[model samples]
Target chain A: MKVGILGPRGTYSEIAARTEFGEEIEPVTYPLITDVAEAVEDGEVSVGVVPVESLREGSVGETLDALAWLDVKVKSEIVVEVDHKLLGTKDSKLNDIKQVLSHPQALAQCRKFLRKNLPDAELISVTSTAKAAKQVSKLRKKYMAAIGSSGLADLYDLKVLQENVQSGQENETRFLCLSKEDSEPTGDDKTSVVFYTEEDRPGILYEILQEFATRNINLTKIESRPSKKALGDYLFFIDFEGHHEEEPIKEALEEINEKVATLKNVGSYPKRF
Target chain B: MKVGILGPRGTYSEIAARTEFGEEIEPVTYPLITDVAEAVEDGEVSVGVVPVESLREGSVGETLDALAWLDVKVKSEIVVEVDHKLLGTKDSKLNDIKQVLSHPQALAQCRKFLRKNLPDAELISVTSTAKAAKQVSKLRKKYMAAIGSSGLADLYDLKVLQENVQSGQENETRFLCLSKEDSEPTGDDKTSVVFYTEEDRPGILYEILQEFATRNINLTKIESRPSKKALGDYLFFIDFEGHHEEEPIKEALEEINEKVATLKNVGSYPKRF
Candidate 1:
């Protein structure tokens, strides 16, 4: 099966795809997360892998919104521990580097290291960390470096000047596997769904939550994003610990659909640690 | 009284500050949102103004986390209509410009305009739009331009190349007035708070929502941010209608504080349209 990922190659998304589908799969690469999702929906690829959440950035809005608007199901999930390293040309020294380039989030994650060690270095935000490594390889500047993964070093033929440079050592990103096909129920599974409140009334959300609580199903995550219709209006994205095929979960969803303006099942898949 | 804002001036934050404190108020400029919050907490300014939310970007995580970490209260909220314009040096021609420099958010907002007009222009992300204007003015490069507000044109003595360049015509940002002092109860007011669930129970959040629902208070917004403790652990930031000083609201908050692991009242302020 052909899998799609955000890449020029060596991006975290590509790493996640390889982790899930094996390193020899040779997944097709897309420039943007939205493009990967589009490829899956259009059948250009059987599955698409994209980052959905991170410890520092919270949820990825584009991925969430794409799932909501398109007819796709989250077939599975994969979690990767992110380690951003400072990469440069073979001859470049860390202390002599004058500038660092990477995606904004990567730059933010390694903020402390850059500020302390390369206090005089300028930070230039690029499209992605992989692109940063690619640029550094092309420029071959004596005083420039990039923050990315060791995988990036191999792909772009760069050297890892420093390892694990991020301020938070515990940073991890959750990636979702999107496909047109749904997954069969596993004993331990998760159902992801989005719902909008039935009306602008008090206690409406309580009514929705009561559906899960009474069934004894635990909620894994819940977030509300603006509906964009107005300031106070919101659409809720929720994840709970259950398969849709389960009797209690089925009953809970039936009750929830009745109380909500709209409900879309993103997918049900085996939960990942 | 002095107000703090994210600046070298001509930023949207400055516009919000002027809207709230009048054009005559002398505002102090900080390079980062965290610095503005710090200025307020340190009593360097009477109050600090910072962007908290926007139609495009749901919430400013830095501001939200800063408010949670600092001992400050949100005094009020100011909504500003964002209108991005393309500005250039006096001798710079629109067709000759090879680069457009601005904040990342501003560049994203003007994606359509940049793609259609200056398709070949290299997009450079700067710290702030005002700083972009400052750079263009100082460099006096005919092939360089900046995306900013019309106010930036006046401040930097640059020419307006184009106006209203954002993709969405109705783009607006919500700025919060932060201070050490809390606000008084107004007839039409809103309360903001953050709380952690007592434990990973099936319906603990439902019970918390019931507290406000039973009191007939409506929730304006609800978002879950990673608590940084673990993967599923979240700190819920919620905004609801009615002032905390109101009898029903006060009683509801008291009840909630008892059931949750922890509860913090951000503040009560008049709701803006």
Candidate 2:
């Protein structure tokens, strides 16, 4: 099987893809989340995996935008424990590190650790954690270090200066596998939908959400993203506790469709969170 | 008055601060949103201005986290038009650019322009757009360019290679002025609140929204962010049309307080959207 991921291997996206498809599948890397979704839509890969949300960073807006605008379905949800380690050259010690590099989100996640330990170190923001590791490896400077998964140390020939550098005890990221078709009804599934309301009035969302509330369809997530037309305009993305093909979920969606200007059923996949 | 902003100067946050306080206020620069909020809470600055959301990028997670966890209050909302320009040394031409440096969001916002014009250029992500411009200015390399506000060209002694390079024409960002106290009741105002529901079941959020619906309160925005405790756990941030001091809004808060595990009235400020 061929899988698409946010690239520069050894990142969390690759780990999520590997966890879902095993180690034998061929991995294709894309620069952005939209590119990965496009690859899935164009059938260049059997499936594409992208980070949807992280416990520390909330939801990934690009992935959400891709799910809203792209012609792809979510096939599965993968949760990966984000374990960031301080990696440096073999000759370097933690005290010798004067500069750190990682993706912005990763740097933010390790803020507390960095502030407490490397107080004066310059934090360099890169495109990805893998790229940070690659840069550090190529430079081989004793004063430089990178924060990423332990898998990166082996991939880039770096040493683990410190383990578990992320802020909270539980740092987990949720990834979505995209493909042409969603998964079959597994009895236990979650459905995701996006909708936009043309009218800006009181209780429009309240009334729309009532469809699921009346049917006792539990919602897992609800987020309002700017529609890009204006500041107050929003596109609501919702995830609920049943598959789209389920009877109650179908009835609720039908009711919601009538109330909203536009509705897109993103997909249904087995619940992972 | 001293006002805190995310800076190296010439950032949108600085512009938002200047827009709200006029150009005479002393601008204090912080490396992170949390630090700006801390400056406000510690009374180091009379107020702090931070970007809360962008039309294209959705909400700023760090800003949301600061509002939810800090003691500072939203004094005002400032909206700034994001006008991205391709800035380079005066000696350089557009085709000479081989690397484009910018904050991740700015880079993402101008993705179309970069992909079309500098297709093969290495896109470098930095901590902030001002930093990108500063780096480009310091290096003075013909192959280096930065995408940021046009004000940056003047601040960093660079020339605008192209104006309005952002993808959309209507790109705007919402910023919040944080102080010790929220604004007094303006006839037309907005209230922001954050709440957490301990129960993970159907209708909890719907029931909470019904409080505002029945009260005929219009919500300007509603977003769910991970509570940082777990993946499915969330803390809801709601912005509605009224001051917290109003009778109807007060009643709704009382009702919501009884329903949720924790409820925090973030602030009420004059509506800007």
Candidate 3:
């Protein structure tokens, strides 16, 4: 199978893509998630991968927004572990490094480490962990190191002076696999939908949410993004704990439609393990 | 007091900063949000002005996260009514313009206008609205126009091809007046807090949320961000309807703290009109 992931190479999506399918799958990298989704929609790629949360940044709003717009659906999910390691030149000593380069998320994950360990080092956030690794590798500058994947260290030919140096021991990123073709539900599934109210009115959200409460349909997550149509109006992206075909959820959503002017079911996919 | 705002020469923030306070306030411009928050935290600047949401990009998580880390509290608010206008060179007629150049947010807000009216024109997003206007001005690039403020058109010496082109009649941005010293809450008040619970232990969220529900406290918003501490663990950023000093809110928080490991009361300020 041919899979597409977002990257310039060595992004967490690349890692997730490989992990999901192993070496048997030929992986293609796209600059943007929208392109990856478009490739699936246009049948250029069988599946696409996107991180649930951003590795370079924090949240991937643009990807989620694109998902809402696309006709494609999520088919699988994977959790990829992330550890920001301090990569340096082969002969470089860890304690003497004066500058630390990393993506914003990596810098954040390793904040506590920077505070107590290399408080004096200047922190510089870049576009990607791999880019930071590449910069340090290319420059071969003394007193410079980067917080990136150990895999990237190998890719750029750097040494991991410290292992799993992130402040948080258990840092992991959740990735979603997308496809244009629908597959049979694996029974255990998750449904994602986007809903927007008719106008900016009070108690409207309460009434809509009441349907889920009444049916005891637990919502996994809910995020509000600007509708761009009007001021104060928001589009809520909600994830519920069951497939769209499930009775309780189907019934609850049908009830919800009466209250919301816009209701679009993005997808229903089996829970990936 | 020194206030830092985004600017070039005649940008809105530079004008707004001067108009808000007299020449007594020294205003500086910072390229990134994190720098502004750091300036506030380090006491290099007395206050930092930041747009609550990016017009092209939507809400910025890194900015909010940086503000949270800086521990700087918003002292007041500034609401700027964004009047997005389509500006182009004198030689370029509106119909002849093949590309619509604007900041991402403006392009997003004017989706309907682009689709319904300028269907022939391809939309191109730029770094900033001022930059877009400047591009048209400096380059005199034919068949290209920018969606920016009317003032920007004047500054760039570009003709206004279209006026008030944003989808929302009230295309506005609320700028926070942040300070290192937490000011006394105004009588008409609001409080914002960030908290995290033991990850996905069913009913743990319910326990904290029930504290508000049982107390009849209204929650304005509840957003979950990765705590970055571990996989599956999340930090909940909540904005409630009542002030922390109020009886019900105070009691509800007291009960919430018992169940959660960490709860930080970020700030209490006047509710912006």
Candidate 4:
């Protein structure tokens, strides 16, 4: 399989791509999540893997907004455990590091370790941890290190100066595989959709929720984003535990359509535990 | 009035501090939103002005999270129009610019202009636009420029090479003046609160919204953030047009408290239009 992913090659998105597809999958790299989705839509790749949510970061808005704007569907989901490592050239020692570089999120995750160990090191933010690792490899700077995955160490022939240096030990990120084709019903699935209410009334949201409540459908996620036209205007992104083609789900969607200004189904895929 | 703000003297936050308080007020600067909130909580400042939301970027999660964690309350709100300018050293020219520096958000807002004008110029991200201007002034690089408010030009003794470079003409940021004392109820007031549902059931959210629907309160904003413990766990932040002490609003709160697992009243203050 050919998978489009946010990458320089050894980032978490690459890890997610490898997890969802086999390790032998061909990887096409994109600079941003929107571009990754675009590659999938334009048939440059069979599928795209992008992080949808993080335990501490809430929602990855860029990915969500891209999904809402593009005519793509979710093919599968995978949750990857985040373990940020301190990578350095094989000849370098931890005490020799005078600078650190990584993506902002990865840098943030390992803030405590960085502050305590390399208090005087110049911290730089790059586009991705993989890119940082690549730069470190090219420079072979004994006084520089990059925070990335252990897989990056193997990919770039670097060494893990420290393992799992992130402050939050329980961090995990959820990734969604995007494609033009929707997943078939697997009996256990989740439906994702983005919708706008017809009016900005107090009970308008309540009325829409009633449709699902009456049918005993369980919602897994609900988030609101500004429509970008005004301050208070919003669009909701919801994920529920049922395929859209299911009878009760279809009826509820019809009822919801009557009360909403617009609705777009993001597609149903088998739930990943 | 004394206001704490995020600053290096010429930031938009400093402008907000001057706008909400008189120009004569003393402005204290902090490095982070949490520190500003801490200054207010620790009685170091009477009030603090922090950007809470922007038309493009949803909520400033740091400020929202700080408000939730601290004992501070909202005193007033102000909205500032974001007009980014291309700033340069005294002897610099636009044609000579080979690099640009600004906060990532400001850089993003002016992507179209930069692509057209300085396509080959290296874009560098700094902690704040004010800091960018500071760096440009110190370096005096004929080929370097910064994107920031026009006020920064005077503060850093730089020149405004170009005006209104942001892509969105309607860009504005909503700032909340946080204080230890809550504002007394004005006839037109907005109440803010954060609450968690007892369970993630289909109808549980509808039940909470019904409390406000029956009370005839108009909701201005509603956003959900993950509780950070797990994927589906969430907390809702709601802003509505009513004071907590008001009769119907009081009853709605009582009803909401009965149905939710936990509720936190952020505060009520006069709405800024």
Candidate 5:
């Protein structure tokens, strides 16, 4: 099977894909989350994996946007523990590092570590952690290092100088496996839905949430994103316990459908978290 | 007055600061949102302005984090129309641009423009749009361009190659003016609050929303972010239509406080949206 991921490889999205599909699957790379979703929608790939949220950084807006707008359903959810490591060329020492590079998010995650250890180092923001490691490997400079997964050090022929450099100890990223159809009913599953309310008023959202509350459905996550039409206007994405096929969930969604202008059922997937 | 902004300068944050204060106010630049908040908290600047949300991009994670963790209050909210321009060296033409550099969000906002016009041009992520313009101006290459506010062209000695390059036409970014104290009730103000519920039971959030609903309080925005403690754990940031000093809002908050583990009133600010 072919799996699509946000890439040039060695990203947490790839790790999530590998964790879901195993090592024997063929991996196809896309530059953006939208691209991965498009590939899944077009059937160019059997499945696409994209990071939906990180414990430290919160939800990935692009991934949320893709889920909200794209014609793709989430098949499963994958959770990966983020293990940020300081990688440098073999000859480089922690004290000799004058500059650090990584994706901006990764750099922010390790802000405390960098401030205390490499206080004067110039922080360069690149596209990805894997790309940062690649640049450091190509430079072969003793004064350059990258913050990423230890796997990057192996992929880029660098050494892991330090492990768990992120500020938070329990850093985790949640990824979604996207396909043409959602999974079948699982006893332990989660349903994701995106909806927009045409009217902006007091208790509009409260009324919508009442459906779930009345049904006793536990919401795993709820976020409001800009509708792109206006600043205050929003598209709400909600994830709740129970599959869509379940009677209570189906009833709640049916009731919610009456309160919102547009509603899209993103998918029902086995809950991993 | 000294106003801190997320900047090298000419960023939307700077524009927000100028909009909130005035053109004559002294502008202090900080490299990150947290730094801007820190400056305000430390009295390095009387007030700080940072982008909180964009119509196209949603809430800024860094700004949200700063609000949750930093000792700053939202004195006011400012909304600025996002006018992204394609900037380049004096001699650069649209067709001659081989690479585009910008903050990741800016680049994402202009995804459609780049895909249609500069199909093969490399997209480079920089620390900020202002930094991208600075880099492009320094290089003075016909093949280099940056996506940012048109004001950047004047600051960096570049020319505006194109106007309004972002994907959406109705793009607007909401900014917050941060200070030691939140604004006094303006009658038409909004209160922001961040809270965490220790219990993960169904209807916990719905019950919290009921406090507002029962009192007929309108919610302008509601979002859940990872608490960084663990997966599935969240800190909810809510914006409601009332001043914290209002009797109904105060009563609702008291009820919510009893329900949640912790609740912080981020501030009451004039609602610009």
Candidate 6:
């Protein structure tokens, strides 16, 4: 099957795709989620891997809204540890390199590296980590380099001049596998959905949530993004620890849906550790 | 007054600081919000300036917790428009350059630029825009540059090779001015507070809101972040368009407080635009 991970060239998405589909699988690259989603919709690709945190950045809403517009199904999920690496061409040696190029996240994650090692150097953020690595390789500029991932450095034939560059040691990113087809249940599974509260009145959400509570089903995560219809009104993205076909969770959600104004099941798939 | 903004030198924070305090103000540069908060708490700086979106990134909770722990007060606010710029050392010559660095937000905001111009180059991330500019200067290498604010580029002796790198035309950031000494209210004001529900029951929050609604006070924002103590329990961060000192706001809050398990006034400050 043709699979895709976000890439202009080297990104965590590339790392994730390889981890999930095996290194030998040919991976289609896209610069944006829309393009990836479109590839899946157009039958150009069977699946598109996307980052869960991309939603946290507000762009996820655009992607989701685009998906609703595109009518594509979210079929699976994959999670990867986000490890930032500093890559430089043969010329941008550590001895003289002054500017570090990377995606903003790579830069943020590796703040400690910048502070301690290149305290006086400039940090230039690029579009993606892989893009940074590709640039370093192509330019071969001295006193300049990119901070990306080990995979990118390998892809671009650059060197891992530095690694573990982010501020938090426990950095992992979750990605969703998108397909036109739904997944068969994996016993240990997760169901992700987007739901809207029934009304502006208080306790309405509690009523909807009580459905899950009464069934003793566990909810793993919940996040709210503004609906734009009203300032405080929101669209909730919820994930719970169970398959949609399962006993209690399936029953609880049936009840929960009745109470909510809207509930769209994004997908159900094996939960990645 | 000594003001603090994001810096070693050059950044939107530096521009924000200068705009609010002018060139005469002594500005202490901080790499992170917690550090700026620390500077304010220790009396090393009179006021701390921070980007609001950075708060959304999870630092606000820590900074607020720091203030709650340190008892530093929010005195005033100064909102600034964060304009991303494509900057390079004058000699780096745009199209020839292969690496670009920037803060993550700058990079994200300017995705379209990277996709169109440096589609093949690696995009690196950095902790801050100023740091990116500084690194480029220090690297003194060829084909490397950064995207930052105009002010930051100047601070590092870089040139604005391209302007308006942000994807959004109206993209602007709001910065908060915080201090330990509380200021008397300026007429236009807003109140921010943290509150917890008495129970995980429905209508409990609606009951609290009835008081505000009755008083005709509009709530600007109400966000829930995990209390981190329990699975379902959450702490609510609320902002409303009124001064706590106002009679209606005082009476309404007094009534609402009687119903909650806990409540804390984060602050009431002039709603500076």
Could you report the DockQ of all the candidates, in the order they appear? 0.42, 0.57, 0.18, 0.38, 0.57, 0.11
lDDT of 6 by residue, A246-271 (tens): 88877877887887777788778887
Taking the tens digit of each residue's C-alpha lDDT, what string does model 3 give over B124-195? 655577777887898897788999888787788999888878876436565677786544645677677777
lDDT of 1 by residue, A1-273 (tens): 688997668889989999999977868987556678889999999999998877666677667777777888999999998989999999988887998999867887887898799989988767689889989999999788999999999989999999989986447889999999768998999999998764677887888888898889988888776666554456888999989999999999999898777899998999885
Off by over 4 Å in 5: A230-233, B230-233
| Model 2, position A143: C-alpha lDDT score | 100
Q: What is candidate 6's DockQ?
A: 0.11
- The 10 consecutive residues of candidate 3 chain A with the worst lDDT sum are A53-62
- Model 3 stretches with alpha carbons more than 4 Å out: A54-58, A115-122, A181-184, B3-45, B49-52, B55-58, B62-72, B77-175, B180-191, B195-221, B226-234, B240-265, B268-273
lDDT of 5 by residue, A21-110 (tens): 898878898877788999998999989999887755567878888888889999999999888999999988899999999987788889
Each prediction's whole-model lDDT (CA)? 0.85, 0.89, 0.72, 0.83, 0.87, 0.68
TM-score of chain B of each: 0.94, 0.94, 0.86, 0.94, 0.93, 0.89
Clashing pairs in 4: none
Worst 10 residues of 3 chain B by lDDT: B51-60
Off by over 4 Å in 4: A7-9, A25-29, A44-46, A87-146, A152-159, A230-232, B1-9, B22-32, B44-46, B89-98, B116-127, B131-143, B229-232
Off by over 4 Å in 2: A230-233, B230-233
Tens digit per residue, CA lDDT, model 4, A1-273: 788998567889889988877799989887567779989899999899998877545567667777777889988888999988999999999999998988766776787898799989987766678888988999999998999889989999899999889986436889999999879999999999888764676777777878888899987777776676554456788888999999999999998988887889999999884
Worst 10 residues of 4 chain A by lDDT: A225-234
Give the per-residue lDDT of model 2 (tens digit) for B1-273: 899998668899999999998989899988678889999999999899998877555677788888888898999999999999999999999999999999877888888999899999998877789989999999999999999998899999999999999887448889999999999997999999999888788899999999999999999888886686654466999999999999999999999999988899989999988
Record all residue pairs in model 1 with backbone atoms less than 3 Å apart, i.e. clashing: none
Q: TM-score of chain A for candidate 5?
A: 0.95
Higher-lDDT candidate of 4 and 5: 5
For model 4 the TM-score comes to 0.85
Rank list by lDDT: 2, 5, 1, 4, 3, 6
